[model samples]
Target: MMHAVVVFETLWGNTEQLAREVAAGLGLESTDVVDAVSAPAMLEDDVDLLVVGGPTHAFSMSTDKTREAAQQQGAENIPRRGIREWIASLASPGRDIRVATFDTRVTSPRLPGSAAKKAMKRLVALGFRPAAKPHTFGVHGYSGPVADGELERARRWGEELAATR
Candidate 1:
């Protein structure tokens, strides 16, 4: 079985919840789910998969500025660091490690860009192979009780990713 790490950055907890569900579907015994602030900067030798996720901000991943804006909007427990900074800090893996990316976005008024897409590109540049196409889960609003069935959908996506390994 593949060993996987799921790292997520969230403002309203929706992305973090999806990350947990995804990790659960990946088989909890083989997966480790962590918040971006606590995620490792380098992949362990035993890790075969790296899954990353964050909430979309300004059409892509959150920056310090965006995070501050979110805080101003009543978001609490916001991470000091976001996926962008965490990804920037990652050391290139010594071997090919499969990677997948996901994001949580508002359900209404379809977005123009994706944090997952940006994250996937960055991971690829750092020598990780794409395990699957980027995915997006929906939320009712910035601070959301995620969209009705998005959690289940995210788990299904994780299951599909596990099958690829």
Candidate 2:
């Protein structure tokens, strides 16, 4: 049996909703959505997959400056460390872990660069193999309810991810 950890950094809850849906689609027993504020330094030994997510900021992963901008925009609950920092903080797992990454971005004429893609690169550098392609779920704006039918898409994506494992 495969067990997964779904962790995310959500400024406006869009990523949170997506993360829950994805975990549900993976047939996970519960939506153990770990926010960046509460993420641990390492994955559990029994975990088979690690699903990481966050909102894209300034065409890539959120930095301290971007997090500060989010806070300045009345985001009272913004975390001090984003996924980038979390990835950097992770120590070697002492075992191989399959990894997947997703990002939430606004739908625009020219989309911002994906945090998911960058996160995958970092994870690969740390020596984890990817279990799925980097994914992006679109938001309407900075603070979003997510696009129409995105939750279903996320669930389907999760299913696909599980099939690969």
> What does candidate 1's lDDT look like per residue over 105-158, in tens digits?
999988788999999999999999999999999999789989999999988888
**Which parts of model 1 are misplaced by more than 4 Å?**
none
- Please give the distance, in angstroms, between residue 59's alpha carbon in candidate 1 and its true position after superposition: 1.1
Model 2 score (lDDT)? 0.86
Report, for every candidate in turn, its global Cα lDDT versus the true structure: 0.92, 0.86
Per-candidate RMSD vs. true structure?
Answer: 0.9, 1.5
TM-score of each: 0.97, 0.93
- Least accurate stretch of 10 residues (summed lDDT) in model 1? 24-33
On residues 1-165, what C-alpha lDDT tens digit does candidate 2 reach at each position? 677889899888899899998998898653357987688887777888889999889889999899889888877668878899999988766678888999999876457599999999998888788998999998887887799989999999889888886
